[model samples]
Target chain A: MTAGAGADAGVVVGVDIGGTKVLAGVVDAGGRVTSTARRTTPGRRVVASQVEDALVEAILESAGGRHLAGVGVAAAGFVDSAGERVMFAPHLPWQGEPLRDLLEDRLGCPVLLDNDANCAARAEAHHGAARGAASALMITMGTGIGGAVLLDGHVLRGANGMAGEFGHMQVVPGGRSCECGRSGCWEQYSSGNALVRDARALMADQPSVLTDMSDGHPDRVTGPMVTTAAEAGDLVARAAFASVGDWLGVGTANLVAALDPEVVVIGGVSAAGDRLLDPARTSLQRTLVGVGHRAVPRLVAAELGPEAGMVGAALLVGGDGTRTAAP
Target chain B: MTAGAGADAGVVVGVDIGGTKVLAGVVDAGGRVTSTARRTTPGRRVVASQVEDALVEAILESAGGRHLAGVGVAAAGFVDSAGERVMFAPHLPWQGEPLRDLLEDRLGCPVLLDNDANCAARAEAHHGAARGAASALMITMGTGIGGAVLLDGHVLRGANGMAGEFGHMQVVPGGRSCECGRSGCWEQYSSGNALVRDARALMADQPSVLTDMSDGHPDRVTGPMVTTAAEAGDLVARAAFASVGDWLGVGTANLVAALDPEVVVIGGVSAAGDRLLDPARTSLQRTLVGVGHRAVPRLVAAELGPEAGMVGAALLVGGDGTRTAAP
Candidate 1:
């Protein structure tokens, strides 16, 4: 393919280290992935170095000996506002780890690090669903909910670089107990885990195609299983989406009340598209206040596929991290 | 007293229009009020012109023949992003009313208009509790909750200027009903009304000092009466504060999770001081995530009293509006 913005900037590799896997990609300036590699994350149980080993393995394979510009790493963790260290990560063993500096020293090149949600938002802001919006909220629902705030063309990293931890925002008092030790978190009601929980609960009360799909074992049901069943017109799966989607709208309304963003983009499990967003829109309209006097921002699903994290990580490098360094 | 910052600039008057009162003040640049006047607010039932009449009376009274530099209006309503019109208010007559232009046409001087919560936040940011903080959240609780966000040096006004509407955020699903046509808003559990609700609920279970204080009528109880009772060491009153304060901390923990501000300033009912905030601080520490890992933003009461709205409004007209234009 002819070179675009990413290629013009030189060949750069981006890596997205998530809960279950590490995905690395060779990206061009145009936000397209030319080649990719993946590995099952060694995870937190292993030494922190082992996880880095898997990351390096994926990155080197994706580069394929191309002259490298720089590399960007987007990890599902609390990256400091200066993008210097990973303060903490629930799924990865990174606590106060200076991943960026360490990676730069090991690779002998530039390295950029940031929160995965922020990177995803930056990608949307630059090329995907949220382009041109002055203020936007990016909500990505995977095993849990992740969020990033964009204001005046920049991600609003808070005092501790933890500004967009939206999943923990309490939506229900004394409702569901969250792993965060807080009850009634928004994620407890609207995430991949919540979707599966709803599906399993639905099976207990009524008949479902999922019973056979999961071999009559509720524990066997996964998020992808429900999504596929719902796509094929299963009532139990569709109901679960409606339930989770409604909860998503409630939380979005709460956020809209606070931030009044110009747009909201739903990523992660967003391949479900209208099935998840249509009900959310209805609930958002019902829950939001001052509807007649104020503008209700558009809610849209992410345009990018699973590669959003990797592409967005690449965008963070921005023609190589040698210039426009992270602040 | 000699003038501080206010005298160095020209003479300015600020008006705060609330649900029940219209307070006007002649404020100097040093954030001090030299003279003041008050009038009962005509509220939303009256024609828009009548409310303006009350404002003009207070403005004239406070100015007391001093040459006016400018006038600022802090209304309990939604101010447009351009600061030109009052888009809507729960307790006032403004609905897309161009108060700024109308006042300028009549008085022939510059007029700046903004939301009362934003005005209060500006006061704290300029010279009160949040001074010198890199970022802060100002939450003022009276009949309900009012909030504003300060980032860097400027108040972070979002799209349509409706940012920081924190009171209406849903904290309970299918819980208390709010006047905003929503259920379980944060204000329902943590505002003046919530305190009274807790006090009245407590009164139902036992005989207490509130019975004599309110003349044996629960409806006769007022916020001030409860505060006085609590100050005098009434267990029931103290419990009510604890209840409301705990809810305040719960809601605050939610906000901190999302924004991670450097400071949180509590205004309005803050005259109770440690009586209210001590419980909130304890609960905030208990409920916040990553307790040992993240910095717990200081939770403090606002220093300015009832005059914060007026003082902040005056500051909006800094050194004359002809210089640093509002953008």
Candidate 2:
């Protein structure tokens, strides 16, 4: 195999099963998506089989009769250290489901499974940002934050394949309740949900474009609405990004203190780009320990954008059972 | 060279330079100290050479004219990734000092230097509680919190050699101020200083044995005094452990959430052992994300106790400059 993603090997399909959508892409050897299909995600409230059906539909739609090298599936959940079962998913109706085998049997091909953030990191490490770094941290800020750690270009899957769960780390004690049944998680203050929440909280006190955009209902304010208004130079929307970005920096500073990566690549809800990163970078520099004495890691937006998860998953088409096990 | 510590190799000296003391020990290959010496730490208020002088005096006293394999010095500071200079230290008056060269010059032998927490982790991974674990997180709760991360039996020093600096992670925003100039550092709530601070705060509420033990001077209460009184079942002192231990578990939970190591070995002011671990463990279980769904890393006490740092430093005696260098 040649260097750089082994792209000439064959075409592979990657599927990212997120909270609200099932996204599938047919990725060429050069880490480019040739075709794509999307399906509404039957979320955590639905049966596991229904979600699997949606995944199957999207995968087949994306395939478009192309021969497949294999399929890599990225899920928003606690993938077992073996990368075989989805022990639990905060957004998906999965509980110890052997997702790989089930998908393989249905599709008649080798199937690989990993965390969504790991897939995004793989995409970035191979073709996007965080390239050629000895160590990197990938944080995807969509919905809730998802994290992955790469050391020497390989994902450092901890004892349970659950390392890099940065979002749930407590940034504020008893500050905000999370769906994970914890309070004050980093994601609670820094993700898309957090962006929307802050916008709504700000709407309660002042006049804002968001109130009109969301039809005067705070609950209807979405992440996209806030980003759009922020781009249009709305003060309230800008305030939300500032608050969320500052918190993003605060949480990242905590991680930087512990992991000291070469760079941190942010993906998922990163459409705001500099609007999100500038504040985050400022706070990262302000809060990191030994700030002036050591190299401050650079914080940058992810190069792969929304397609990163699927592109990274597609890269896993090759074989390595080092962290893969099936029962 | 042999199965274990290579005890047949030769005798080496290990020195741990802390904010309060310079502890030196002559350690054999079996990780046992044959002789020990201690001197007061000159601290951040003094010049770097004065601190270095104290270290030299203690190392000579411990050596007692025995032949030496080499010397390994562990500093409670940010040792650069090359293990050459101490970039900065909180308690010691070191600011990017060429510590290894300084020690090697005076002693006329090879000198290895590393962060004290990294040294402690090496000792535990080799001969103590975390032995045989593929991935381990070591948190030393002494005057402040120190952390180290090991992957595949080697320390994962980050891009700046500052990985595993877990103590500065912010658990409470705008909380307590730390010497590092950051507010709400994890150590501010869960270390020896935290123990003393909490004990003193409790003393202000009611008449406790600590009040009499400190001679009614709340500021005079020390970590050992609190530990001693807690072991003796003093209610107020026990309350302090409950607070510190719970915070310990809280900060550890954050680290575990991020690193997800196979084991977490806590040392340093771990003298309280169960009094510290039991409460920490309970809180860890309650706070860890996906707690029941994944393998919760076992939190254990450091077996080598205070000597782990010196022993680990000694382990660096015969090594390639894998992460070591001197100018």
Candidate 3:
């Protein structure tokens, strides 16, 4: 085979299944995405079959008659060390299912699977936030928190490929119980859920300006709503964001203390702008040990946005797994 | 150079200096220690000259008349990334001193410097607890705490080479003020100091048996004393250890969540058999975020003990940095 052909021979179809939608694309050599398609994620009822059908259709559309290679899927939850099974996913229907083999069989190609956060970090390391970084960590603060680590330009997949669960790190004991069955996990304090929780809690106690905006419906307070109200000079909404920012800083500080990453890339819906980041940056520095004396990692927002998982999934599918997995 | 010699050519002298003693040895290929010697660490009264002379003698003795290579000295505190200097060491006399050059001139050999905890981790990764492991963290819970990370068998020396300062991570906000001027650092709640703090606090508040044993002299109730009291079934001492264990588990859980290490090695004086480790292991498992479902990294006591630094330093001095540094 020609050098270029051999290099591109492993083109894998990448699929990113998020809570709200499924995005699929063909990723080839040099980390390029070909044809792409998107569809809403099916409801819990008949979700498995619906997701599979949507993924298959997306894969077919993305191939567009081109020579297909393998398939790579990035979703939430713990993936096996082999990157061929979904042991458990909080957001998806899959639990201890051999997803890779099933997808490979349907697509007529080999398949690999990984945590979505890991895929995002891989994508960033290869082409985005961590393009030329020596060591970096990407943390997505959304509905739930997701995280990825890239060391020496390579993703650090732990023994079980369950690495980069940065959101679940315990920030405080007996604080708040998470859906993951753990209390005071970093995500419960820094994620979209945490933001909404904070805003709702504040609105419940104090008669705030957001009350008029929400028409006295406390349940209507969402992450974006809090951000908007904060920007519009709402005291309770701003305090909620600041509290989440403090937790975010605490989480980042803990990560830095452990890994000493050269850079930390913040992503997900929470990274809408400087509204959440300013407080996060200040708190990260304030909480960091030896803040002034050491070369603390630079905290920057992710540039690739929602597409990071898609690109990263493509790379994971197209490239050899050796580069992504730690030695 | 012959193949065998090429792999082992950089035989740098390595020394592990601690509060109570100093250890020096000749490290060869494959992390073997050839000549070894130890001496009581001189006090601050006759600091610089005494320490320098001791170091020079150790290096010459360890060499055993072989053509000497460079030196790798591992000490405490925020070690300057440069192979030639120490920025600040709280326990030691020097500050921003050209230690490498001074040692080089004294012995006419190039020298490399690192934090002693990092040296211990290198030793463990190369030959002890974390051997054959791809990703792990080594924590020395001594009079204070020290930390190091091994990802894919490589040490993560952050942008400034001071990456693994884990003991400084905040476990509790406004809990306890550390010597580093930070309040509620992990070390304050989980190290030897933590044990002492817990014991002292317990003795003062509760009518513990230790009050009778030490007769209200908190200084007399050392870590070993607490261990002895616990072994004899002293409830308060056991409770104190349990508290430390919980914090230990918390700190380690934080580390695992942040770094996703495949193994965690607990070293230091406090890890004297099962007194500390039993609770540590239980607490670690309980506090771990995805404990039962994921490939949980092993939490085991270190086998190398105080000798780890010397052994690891020998390994560092003997081999090219590529294997451990670049993996």
Candidate 4:
């Protein structure tokens, strides 16, 4: 493959450290991935160092002897404002760990750290659906909802680097209990987990294609399974999507009321294209405050898909392929 | 009275055009009010020119023959990003009017316009409770829950200069209907109207001191009357404060999750010291997401009280009293 601009100088590594897996890729200045590597994440039960080791292995495999300039780690957790530590990651084993320093020390290169959702938002703003939008709110509907706010083409990292934790915003008072130890969080009713939970609950009450897909076991139902069934025209699966999409719309309306973004980009694996978005648009229009008077934000699906996090993380490090100042 | 440093150069007239009244003051560089004036706001039923006339009267009366450099109008409405038009004000007569140019021409001076809540937030950030806060979420609990987000000592006006419309955020899924045509907005449950609504509903069921305060008419019950009765240890009135405070806390928690501000300042007329704040604090602590893990923002009462909007508006004009570009 022909090298892109700045590829001859040095390539930067971008790592998306999620709960289930670690995906790393060597990205050039133009956001092109030159090489990639992936591995299963060591579960939270293991020592934190084990997870760090996995990240190192993925980076090394992806680099493939390329001159490394810096590394950007997009983690699914609260990265401190200094971009030096992972304050906490519920699904990962990190609590006030100096991950940035550790990685920089081991990799022999400068390392930048950020929340995964923020990385995805940066990627979308720079190269995907939210490009050219003055302000955008990106919601990633994975195992739970993860959100990032972009204004003037930059991520709005609040007092702490913990801004854009939209999933935890209470949409339903005293509704479902969230793993974050909250009740009625937007994610509890609108995320991948929510879809699975709704589908499983419905399967228990009424027969659905999801039950057969999960081998007639309600407990075995998954988010993607429901999406697959919905794609095949399953009535119960479609209803589950409708329920989650409604909650998503409710939360989006709240964000719109507060942020007034020009657009909202729905990302993550469970977005399921039009199946989730169609209902979300209907509900958002119905529930938006000042519906007739105010400008409604355009809601669209994310273009970069799963690779957005890594691509964004790589871009966050300066154009020269070195660590940049915190956003 | 001795004139402040820049007072002799030229003073800026700051006008706070609220729903009930027009409060105008001549302010110096050090944020001191040299002279002040107030006029009853012509209700929304009147033509837009009548309201503009009231603002003019207030400014001219407050000028006190001082060498005026410019004027800043802080209105209880959505000012456009260009600081020109008032999009919509629930309690005012303005509707897509070119208020800034009209006022500038009429007064023969450069004029800046902004939302009252944004002005209050700026004042708080510069000279009040949120003075040293890195980021602050200021909630003004008056006729409704007007809010502004301050970052790095500057107001974060979103894409359309309508970022701080926090009152319209849906706190209740299918609760009370709001005038904005949305159901269960935060303001609908936690505003001055909500406080009075709760107190009046309680008055119908039980005897209270408010009956004597409001001449035994539930319709006549005001926010201050409820505060007075609650201070007098009336159970129903105190319960009303508790209910409103709880919703306030719930919304604050949601804001905390989304913005993670360093501080949250409760302002406006209905936030009567500890009466409303005590229960709000309790609810904020109880409902805050990631309660044990995350850093909880300091919640406090506004220091400047009602005059904040006027002072902040005057400051927005410029350091030298000329109208600066829109914030």
Which candidate wins on TM-score?
A: 4
Q: In angstroms, give how far residue B249 of model 4 lies from its true place.
A: 0.5
Top-scoring candidate (DockQ)? 2
Q: Write the per-residue lDDT of candidate 3 for residues A51-109, one digit (tens) a residue.
A: 78877887777767666666667776678878877787666677787777788778777
Candidate 4 error regions (>4 Å):
A1-9, A204-207, A269-271, B1-9, B269-271
What digit string (tens of lDDT, one per residue) describes model 1 on residues A1-327? Answer: 111234445578889998899999988768888999999998788888888889888998898876667888899898987888998898999898999888888777678888899888878877788888889999998888998888755778889888888998878777799998878889999999999999999998888889999999999999999999999888999999999999999999988988889999999855688888999999999999778878898999988867877877887775643634442
Q: Give fnat (model 4).
A: 0.70
Q: How close is chain B to the truth by TM-score, in each candidate? A: 0.93, 0.88, 0.88, 0.93
lDDT of 2 by residue, A64-183 (tens): 875455788888877898888998887888999999899989987778899888888888888889888999999888788888888866777889998888999999888899988999
lDDT (0-100) at residue B133 of candidate 1?
84
What is the total number of backbone clashes in candidate 2?
2
Model 2 CA deviation exceeding 4 Å by range: A1-10, A35-67, A106-108, A319-327, B1-10, B34-68, B91-93, B105-109, B319-327
Superpose all Cα atoms of candidate 2 onto the true structure and report the RMSD in Å to 1 decimal. 3.5
Worst 10 residues of 4 chain A by lDDT: A1-10
Ranking, TM-score, top scorer first: 4, 1, 3, 2
Q: Give RMSD to native, each candidate.
A: 3.1, 3.5, 3.4, 2.8
Per-residue lDDT over B214-311 for candidate 4, one digit per residue giving the tens place of the 0 to 100 score: 89889998887888888889998999988988899999989888888899999974347777788888989988776676678889999897889998
Off by over 4 Å in 3: A1-12, A28-34, A47-49, A269-271, A318-327, B1-12, B28-32, B39-50, B207-209, B269-271, B319-327
* Reference contacts preserved by each model: 0.76, 0.85, 0.64, 0.70
In candidate 3, position A154 carries an lDDT of 68
| TM-score for candidate 4 | 0.95
